[model samples]
Target: MPEKIIVAGVPVDTRHFIGGRRVASPDTFDDVSPIDGQVLGPIARGGPAEAEAAIAAAREAFPAWAATPRAERARILHAVADGVEKRIEELSAVETHDNGALLRSHRRGVMPRVAHNFRFFADWLLTLGHDDFETRGHTNHVSWDPAGPCVLITPWNAPLMLATWKVAPALAAGNTVVLKPAEWSPLTASLLADIATEAGLPAGVLNVVQGYGAEIGDALTSHPDVRRISFTGSVPTATRIAASAAANLTPLSLELGGKSPLLVFADADLDLAVDLAVEQYDNAGQVCLAATRILVEESVAEEFTRRFEEKASALVQGDPREEATDLGPTIHTRQLEKIDGFVQRALAAGARAVIGGHRRDGQYYAPTLLTDVAQDSEIVQEEVFGPVLTLQTFADEEEAVRLANDTRFGLAATLATGDRERADRVTARLIAGTVWVNCFFVRDLQAPFGGSRLSGVGREGGTWSFDFYCDLKNTVTAPNGWNNHG
Candidate 1:
């Protein structure tokens, strides 16, 4: 039996799920909780051999799974969603313990979204439409065929939610998957495997391997059998994976890093702008789509900065389990150090720290705000991926658009303006995958999601997801009279 530990009163198993069974590795690594730096348990350490085994299982299972009826696949995926809903409380606690996100956010928002991901994709698959046309007495039809074994490498920052964002769609399209959860938070993925099994998903249909990216990521990505690769993480890592996948000419869908901007116009509602600014601190500022760079209209820059600084400083930072705590600790000491380093360097370079600029306690960095930084500075151009925000002022719409599109990363951006025409005109000019006006992070599962330029390649969500996970083949019938004459 695999080793089990109790977290938030729920027992969590820390082992790899491959071939529909819990497989133990020769060596194991400790899974320390970021909440208090306590060792949650020892997780199986998988290497190339384990990666090969998991891939083999997925390859063996792909044909039958692909041949399964679309209705049947949809039913199984719905069951998976149902299973997730039944254990929402347990999953929420485990994820909070594993990743140091606020318990309330996970319970109220993230976990529920995870279930919705499965349910939404399942229903969408059944009602999916295809293209068919008739011309010159011949008919042409387009059909989506499932690709073979797919490898999914997910990031630690929104562990299970992000994982299912890809998994649900891949499985719903009849592709088998080998998911590799980030090493820092592998507990919930283990639980997810068990949930899928209970929901009637066949063995080898969904296998998970837990370990560092260096250990098994290459083995899975470079495998000859892997037909599709979908990854969500850093740009450098994605670059390496792209290089490896190039060997086989394997198709890839990458959702990479971002230093997204949020523009606040002078005519915008001050209260709503302030609320949206503070929200960048959500998930400890580890969000890819977060508006970390704030460009305020010159007339309202001072008022907006003061309000943002005051509200950010007052955020309740404490144990994630506490309901009143608005902020949780960073994922670990190293991540905390990295976040602090970004702030310290900006200060040394003549920028002003208007509010927070230091670590408060164990793994808890203060919510930070900076101003008077040059537009071209490293702190403004690069992605900090922490609870840090930088303030800048712009003169007009053209300047706002310029500053927003100045960075190499273009995952997402937001605009806070009361002018409807301005919203339409400016959003059209912004270089982002998703643009929001008077709102932030409001996502519909049916809409397209992903980034552009250095942010990412290809889109996912709705039919865009099926486009990446399946192969579109067209069939044409012979003209009726010509066939008879021949």
Candidate 2:
């Protein structure tokens, strides 16, 4: 049996970490485990007041922390990475229990990557250099400075990892941040706050506020002290945040919803295509970059569907804590019902399910694959965000590119092909920000990652991330005032 994670000496229902201290709230909400519908405990329920306090703390800590040397910031962030690594199992178990992510996935995939994100940014910051040039006999120096207190709002899916995507670079760039993890999955994020403090972060530099977005989200965005905001979630929420942030003219990085596609040409390795399609069902298909729409060459469409169905059908759905479970429940009952509605509407529109197509139990939706879905169908056009994939066939390369770019989303697109020429050709035309050839979900720390269209506003990885959390200032110096006209 796995031991329960002791967060701040409490077994569950963790409190918000504010100003480096655990704070309780008068109002609380029950955090039910999506794994088995069991009540984990009561999590702190906060509102505008809590959001204000968190922003105030971050605001206070920004100047001194920002003034800290680059070498020291790197050292502290490296320590944070080490701290997270040391508490892997404890944190992993907590995340899996709270978010319904399989324990194995957390152990082998997500948690390790979370630690690496911190370490990667830590090293990258050391190499961040100022640009210097001479213009009109004056030496000009450009440097990226901390953007001050910022708000980082992450979604429920892949909670800790996504939070790290925003948090690591913000801190690395010497900005203080208040992170609001999705109310549904706050356990690991709170644990990260504790780890940061234990790793020697200054009090109030990194704070975690736990509450529903409706109550506290706008407060964080609209707070006068918050200089920038980074959010990853649905398109609707992103619009709302954008409106609020605009009130202050706050700079924002929004990673909104995605209806990303996976393209497989006829000449491509059929085996690899099938494998990648099956892999899409991981994380219950709740990924922002998930292969929601599969575009395959008409020649191999039938065979590809047959093999994919077999593999997807073999995926086991059970308790997320179990090591062998492949697919887990949706984050909540509402998500499951939403997924079911998409499938039912598709079926009514004459699409046929190749395999498991319906919702099971309370929140478990089987890995479902649908065929004959119209290009404009709701399931094809919008993001279902479940373990459901819709298949469409394209006649030629031109049609494939056209069909792939048909949606409003332009977050991620994957193409599986053996030919490099074809890969280069299709990659350039795809509207998505990230295009993978012969692969899916392969990420590099140095690359700029985000969406192009309704998917997101700005990039959030590599130097782009460091740039986003900071304001660039250019200074020019000369021995005396020299007028070119004179």
Candidate 3:
């Protein structure tokens, strides 16, 4: 077994994984569990030196790993998937302990998706095709060349799943990676490094550096040797990373903040609409793509609000380990305070909370719903990444579309309509990168996934992932040329 440390009575490896080994940091920081405000363990505190070491390791390993056969790479990724599947329960519990998300959510969907992320990209690599065409008596061959060392900065909301979402494609593309998980949730990332090593991934192919972004993020992002970066986090942080990478001319794929909208038409089913609305409270409304700004048709706004209030109020909030729990605590006390501040400001600005709008205890923020909010208010315009939903009424489809597109964010949107024609028409008019009709959060790995406008910088999924992680090169060969010398 890898080096282990006791965290909240469980053995965990909190050391940095560099150069295919568990390395200790000279300094350490307390990793507090958000569930109960207790110190779980001491996480390795990595700084510029650690970052440089990991980058050098990835740089040293890149060429050999890139030269490996695609078949062997696929097999190793499959083995990693199998290892993740075997530890689903352990990972689920550990994630809940680390980030205060519901364990059931992790076990049921999140962890399983982590495994699938690796498996899907692994299989995708084998089936990936290149273009070869003959033009003007010359053959043009297109190839996807692996980029060098990459940096993946993942969020605390869905740590391992989102990390592997980038990691799988980067590794499958035959590039070395150094992952920097959010400070609030770093245990699962350490676990993932171990899993990848056990699955026969080559030494230095994947490294984990643990610390706050302020301490080590710049060192990784601004490194001249780092070729690409994929970050999933807040807009402010993404902005800083972009600035750092700009100095090196390093390419970046950013999946940032969202204040997305959900439109409910009068012709839609009330129960289904209400069900979808309540689903936003999952993970305490920390989901970036969640339909938090709900726009309901005036005809059914009253009924929808009534049903939504009841469901949101009835959601059981307690320990994530319990199977009966529907919602868990926010990631930390600071985040909880931020959520409360947004609700308080909205209330002072004349909005009414029909359900909940306060912090419950510890790190738990009550699921909140606000009505009569102004279109230009901060609560409506800013991303309140907590268990808060804002509702607005629209006179018609025109007003609904206008209201949904009012914000600068264009990450995602959801629409509920019975008519196919109306769905297509409104979906076309929506400014979001992803628009769901009569459904929400149903994702296919093969589809293009990302944001537009201020929500993100580039896309990631299927070919789009490879497009960012690899360099596309074209080679032209002379076809039976008579004269070679000119």
Candidate 4:
């Protein structure tokens, strides 16, 4: 039986909310489950007008929200955590239907993290500060303040959690938001806005506008009123948003896709390494920092490949709502083709598919694992953003390092080893913004998270994210240097 879900206390329809009002537009799009082509709902398309309304609403609410003390902001955020808990099961079900994120993962991984994001930022908000210094000769201090109302665009992958990473901190820092969710999964974002409202957040403080990025996103980015734009999406789209925002001088932060590599040495714990690599490529490998490229030592290459292929094959592939399902489908029809193209390119470039490498319909790309993948292949160089895991063997420490850094992306990487020395050495050589030793995807909202190189600019989570969302308003202690009042 298909599970029915609701958003914002209202059932799904082609109609979408524009500025907290139920508005119907002739433009409508289907919300299909990636697991299959099941239509959960047909969502309405929002255009520039809706985007402008959302911006206006956020702008109207910005002053008071920004003026509110950190504690008050924290209070609201805390309430959001509480509110989300109430609907956790419903949210999980919707996630399975909308984006095809595994329900069990939603229960275990996504929801708790989403809740923690608010609570984490809430804690940070309660103790906001900037680094300062006092010397014998003079005093120097640096601080930050909210940038203003912002435009945040999040991807379909990890929608609620990643969106919270942007929205939680932005809201906690006193900046209002005009959030444009991915077309594939706007329901959750709508629910978040409703949850905030239910939590007593002032109207327009955290506005959600549902629409196509072409219409809504462009308007929000190009709007004169929007002060900052924080986005998590494709490199192409992010570049466009960055360029458009540059026209108005609105500061921006981004977290783009990744072809993150996992380096496993012969000296590494085989069990742990295999597990970490699998974990990195989990979520049907639909993660930004997923270990799409696996680099292992030539010594353990044969054995590791055997073990990994067996383990990777064991991953359950079926309906996301089922507890037994380990992997779900990609976001929608578009990505199915995109991921398929990448797979064909990899095969054409001489990489061998050691395990699963196919798609069912246009949604569920099989949990794939490719081996003997050349470093120069697209699978190694670009972000596949699917359940595909491509493996390449490395000769030694130098070769391992070389293979890991070969990609254009520098989002994150996982290094597995029992040897602390090797771990330290690899950690130094790894090019990513975040390095995980013996683990994968261990994220804490209190810490800075982002990427280097083409992966992205600036950071998210921790105070580092707020730094981008704000500017330092210096309050120099202007000392009277003798006889000002002559």
Candidate 5:
């Protein structure tokens, strides 16, 4: 039996973080751990009132934070990064315990990336400047100004990292923010609020409201004081947010769902292709950018499927606290059933499973790979968001592109090929926001990140993120003796 490890010493209060203090709500809900379906603790369940409070706090803080010198903001962001780094281990543990994510993944991958997000945006803030143009008769200046009070809603898949993805850039661009984390994964986010306060972030600069989206999502999106909203979640929810934002005519950015593709060409490195297929099983396929559709050339399809099956089956799905576990349980029972249903439907449609076609335990679904699935089948077309990969073979590059681009989502895609020219050509034709030629999940913090089509609207990361959190302000100065009719 594996030794059970429980996270201790961290405050388990799941209250809202407003104005640098923890505030409790009249009502609350239990946070159940997916690991064994036990109640971890009760979390303050917030509603419109909580949302209003957070937005008001941010509204009050916007002017001072926006007016602070760029260098000063950069310094404070670095301190926030430092605080996260110092408490990295505990923070990762809290995330693992709350989200049922693998311990190693949070400790090494997500936590460090969260810290990097802060530092990257802090460095980018230093390079921000006003553009000046002196023409024959007049001078013009263009500058970036904070978007005032903003609402940042992040998903639960990688809570801290995704939160930082939105928060760091918004703050770096001088916007005071109200963050609404997914209720399923709120522990790390609540902790991050305390960490940021300790790092010298002023009161009301950053507030976290923890509750269900149905309760407070509209409140945040439709509030008149909110200048912008950045969201990452499902398409249906995004549509609702869009509608709410429209009521106030507020600016918005959304990174929504994806049913991404991973194409393997006949001329590609076979070993590398197999490796990449197995890698998509990471985070138990809960990632938005995960390659759920595997499109392989007919010639190498058999070999690739064999190797990929071996690797996928070998992945350990055990206790998240266990060091050797490669994958953890799904975020909740509903997710586990959803993935299981997809595999069952595919099987019913005559698809063959090479391995793993059943759920193991509480919130634990086996790493599944389906072959011979029809191109238009529900499993192949929709986002499974689980540890399931469906394979389909194509005869040529054109067919492969056709099969890959069939989905409404164009968030991310990956292709494996040794030829640089082919790689470049195929990637250009691929309808994805981000395409990887020979790699998987190799990200640069400075690159613009988001999807096209239904995947997302607008972008984040690098200067793109800064621009989203701010509005461009332009000024014109006329010459001393200028006339309107001149």
Candidate 6:
């Protein structure tokens, strides 16, 4: 049975939102819940026109929002935080219904963190503190201003958290925005817009647009009025958006994918490394920086593989909505096929699946660990973006670094070592945007997060995001006795 959900106080098919109004799609597509392949609902299918309208609405609203006082805007943001808190249960239920995530996971983890992000940015806005930049000598520095409309394209895996990563900073910098939440799971983003509206955010400050990416995302990326575009997803898509934006000289912020490596040194904390390694791949190795590759010393490689495979084999795979399910079906059938192809490719190349090797049902793919994957194999070189991981063993510290930095991706890297010398040496060499010396995904809102090379350009989740999202114009005054005009 399809559950009835609301967005912006209006009933939407599958609860997707587009424009500032409530409406259903002319044609609907089944948004199947990943758990058990249960059909979630017939979500409306919006085309390019809907996407264009969303951009137009966002463009219209940018001027008023930019002129609004920062403090006032901050207060409205605080209300949105409160709304998210008040509607926590409702929001969690929608997420659980729409996604395969456990309700407990939603209630306990996702909601609170989202509220925290909203509050964190609100506090950050206040810290802007009426701008008291010091000017030395003849230079005069006043307050910097906002750019204009921004379009945020986020993915399904982390709908709200990633959306907040862009929205919070962009708004805090005083720019209005158009948000294109991933079509697969648009519920959270839709409801978030409603919550912002209820929280007294002036209309047009934020416009949530939902639809297929090729049409919607393309419209957003090439929208003439959109001064900034910040997106998080695959590299090929990021490359396309960058090219489109370059045509207009529009600034873009990209948070692309990664095939991050996790290094476990000889002198490292064995228990901690083992524990994190096993648990890291639990979310089906579907995280952007999930330490997909483990490059360990040859001595301990056998032990690590044994423990890792043992853990992977024992994990319970099923419905994400069920509290007992440790693992669930992937988001879609296409992803399952992608993962299956990687496994087959590995097997054909003489690689072995120590734990999981095949599919159970339509969307249910077992958590898999591939051993003896060649450096040139597709799985090792490309971002599988699924539950599959390829294992490798390294000889010395230098070999460890080489293996870790082998991939073209530079998103995040982790080091496991009890020895300070080994930890420092390996950490310094890992070519990732974020490196965890003794941890994984211990994200701080205050820390600037982004990637290097193909991973992305520009930063997010810090004061730096606000700085880059806005443009700075210089004003120079000439003194009466200044150099004579020639």
lDDT of 5 by residue, 1-486 (tens): 111123446665577889888788888877777788887777888899999999999999999999999999999999999999999889988888888888888888889988999999999999876668888868898788998998999998999999999999899999999999998888888878888898899999999998889898888999999999999999999999999999789988999999999999999999999999999988888999999899999999999988887777778888998999988999988888888888998899899889898999678888888888877789988888999998999999899999999988999999998889988888989998899988999999878889999898998878788778889887888778645655
Please provide, for model 3 over 1-486, each residue's C-alpha lDDT reduced to its tens digit, 9 standing for 90 to 100. 135766545578988999999888888888888889998878899999999999999999999999999999999999999999999988988899999899888999999999999999999999887768988979999888999999999999999999999999999999999999999999999989989999999999999999989999999999999999999999999999999999889999999889999999999988899999999998989999999999999999999999988877889998988899999999988888889999999999999999898889889988999999999999999999999999999999999999999998999999988888999889999988799888889998899999998999989999889999999998999877666565
RMSD for each model, in Å, please? 1.7, 3.3, 2.2, 3.1, 3.7, 3.8
Worst 10 residues of 1 by lDDT: 477-486
Worst 10 residues of 6 by lDDT: 1-10
Q: Any runs in candidate 2 off by more than 4 Å, and if so which?
A: 1-13, 479-486
| C-alpha-based local distance difference test score of model 5 | 0.88
The alpha-carbon root-mean-square deviation between model 3 and the true structure, to one decimal in Å, is 2.2
Q: Give the per-residue lDDT of model 1 (tens digit) for 289-325.
A: 9999999999999898878777777889899899999
Which of the predicted structures, 1 or 6, would earn the higher lDDT when compared with the native? 1
* 2 against 3, candidate with superior TM-score: 3
TM-score of each: 0.98, 0.96, 0.98, 0.93, 0.96, 0.92
Off by over 4 Å in 6: 1-19, 23-25, 129-136, 474-486
Q: For model 5, where is the 10-residue window of minimal lDDT?
A: 1-10
Clashing pairs in 2: none
Extract clashing residue pairs from model 1. Answer: none
Clashing pairs in 5: none
Per-residue lDDT of model 6, residues 62-102, tens digit only: 78888888788888888888998998787777766565555
Clashes of each: 0, 0, 0, 1, 0, 2
Error of 5 at 351 (Å): 1.1
Off by over 4 Å in 1: 481-486
TM-score of 5: 0.96
- Report the lDDT of model 1 for residue 94: 95
- Distance from true location, Cα of 409 in model 4, Å: 1.0
